[model samples]
Target: MNTNDLKIFEAVAAHGSFTKAAEATFTVQSNVTARIKSLEEEFGVELFTRTSRKVALTTAGETLMQYCKKINHLIDEAKYDIKNAGQIIGQLKIGCIETTMALKAPEIINYFAENYPDVDLEFRSAMRSTLISEVLNFKLDAAFVSAPVSQPELDQIHIRDEQLVIVSSAQTAKISEVLNKQPVKIIVFDQGCIFRARLESWLSAKGIIKYKSIVLNSLEGIINFVEAGLGITILPAEVMEHYYAGRKLIAFPLNKELGTMTTVLIYRKDVPPSRALQVFADMHKVQG
Candidate 1:
């Protein structure tokens, strides 16, 4: 009936489990149950069905949930509109890819924090896929993700375009030479990585698929290995150009489609961000 109850209902619907919703909402399980009960009593319909292990929504619950989501989004928009009418102040949880941490994230965070000290900010580094899912589920206020991600449940704003380039040790002058070697040692992030996927696809298409690759879980590890002359790797030209020591690496462009990528700001399509987030987003919005 009220906003708090609606928030609880939204969280429960998102996670499909009361306990999980409670944890995400930073409340107790009893509180989540009570809010759901109140909503059910007011609407005269059950919103969830619980069995031994899992919980799901019935037809009535599904219908009510759709309306609940709309109502919740409307309330959020109204709040954002009012708060942006003046100085912004609140907490915002932001997500980013590990590659964006060094310069992009720190600059943005520092700029916002210094100007709006009253607003609290939290940062996280995650894979692009995970960041997208978290934003859609409302677990994150917004995120910086590798761009051109097409998802119906999210809104994306293109921030910057990044060109893909091959990075090799300072001692290695040519990539073709490495490819001809016995199982060319390559370092990369795992399967879920956009850069890694693109690199593999490009290599396969180019008839250069006989190389061995090491799959690292972190960007730092990948760069370190490449820096140590262990192998070669690929990354965003903008990011790599800014952070990497030029003396330790040489970067080359990929041919066409595999050559360029974009970084974007992403958030839930239907949910508006808080005032503090809006200010930051507005500042970073790409100019025409």
Candidate 2:
């Protein structure tokens, strides 16, 4: 019925166990059960299907959960807008792809730190698809991703151009040479990586169909594998140039359709823009 009751409901729904929710909220199990009973009585509906070991939200509960998130978000927003009147405050959740994190994320964070020190900033790194999904769901205020994002509910800014290149351990080998001479093993990030998808599409189009692949979750792991003569990978050129230079790795260019990507910052259209996010986006427009 109130914010405290909603918080208890959210915790229980999240953990799916009365005792776990009590532990998370630092309350007793009896208090959690009492609150849920009161809420269910008020609504005259069962919110959860509970068994000894698990809990699942009923249809009514799921509906309440959506409103609960929106209400909680609005409450937080109101608090921030009032407490930091005409100033940037509160925490911002930002996201980036691995390549951007390695290349320019530091400077980006520094820009925010110098400008809005009061705003607590959190940065998360993930593949492009994951970043987009997080932003769309309001989990992230904004994210940096490989561009041409076609989401209807989101607005985006073109951050900069990034050049992707194929690197191999063969110091002077060309793309043609690598394709012709051996069974190329592609080292790439996990399934949701945009660069990996691009590389796969390009190679498939070129009729380089018979190749092996190894999925490395870390950028460093991919680079290490490529440097060790284990496989080849496609990465942002600036990343390799700035961090992994002079490593006997040969960079080969691809056609524009495959090699060039526009980096973009994206956020949801429905959410009211935060001050910190507005400044960060504006900075890229002015300085990028």
Candidate 3:
């Protein structure tokens, strides 16, 4: 019932485990357990069902946890707003896809840093879905994710549309000729990658099936795999310019109707905007 108890319950629900949630909240497992137990006692309802290996939320837990997330977010936002009202001197954590680091990150960070030297910035790069989740969970103040994010709680602002180009080794011209060829290695990032989903759907539409693949966690790994003639990959044109400059990779267009991949800035709409986030969001409003 208390804010501390609700915070503990929220952490447990988000992580789906007591031990993991304890680590995340910088507390011990016993404290997390006691807090949740106190909360359940006060509510006269069992919030979570305990199994030997996993924790599952009961109906009451699910409903309560949803509201807890909102309450916790509000508390954090209020603190951020109060502390940063007149100055910009707090740590701002933003998340992004790995490719965003190449050029866009430097330009944006340099501009922000030079203008507001007191505000410390931290950029965490990961798969797009992970970034989206972090923003939703309040772990990140904001995130730049490949767009079409349909989550109701998050507000998304379109930044730029980057072309998704299919690239193959130049020496393997025959691979380009046959859209549904054998020995096709689809080099892709892990599950949460936006382009990886796009490429799979594209292949399905073209009736190209049974292709080989290599799962890589980083942009550079995918690029290296493709450059070594190990496979072909799809990537945003703007972000991949350096990799394409003198490589044996040949770029091909996805059909025009497929459209460009959209880069978007997403943050919780209901949360009071932090000074750091407000400044960052303002930069996305491209002047005509």
lDDT tens per residue, model 1, 1-288: 787787788788788899999998899999999999988898888888988776788788878766676676567758766766676777788898778776577777688778988788898988888988887656788898887778887777777777889888878777787777777778988768888888888778868778788988888888888888888888888777677766588887798788877788887666556677767777777440
Q: Predict model 1's lDDT versus the native.
A: 0.80
Local distance difference test values of all predictions, in order: 0.80, 0.85, 0.80
Q: 1-288 in candidate 2: lDDT tens per residue?
A: 789999999999999999999999999999999999999999999999999888889999998987786687678888888887998777778899888887776886687788778878788899888999888667898999987889898888888888889888865466676677567789998888998998898889888888888998888899888888787889988888898897868888888888998998898766667777777778777866
For model 1, the stretches where C-alpha displacement exceeds 4 angstroms are 1-54, 58-85, 286-288
- Residue 1 displacement (Å), model 2: 3.0
- In terms of lDDT, the poorest run of 10 residues in model 3 is 174-183
Candidate 3 yields a Cα-based lDDT of 0.80
* Candidate 3: tens digits of C-alpha lDDT, residues 23-113: 9889999999999899888889999999888788999999897678778767877887686678866778888888877747788789877
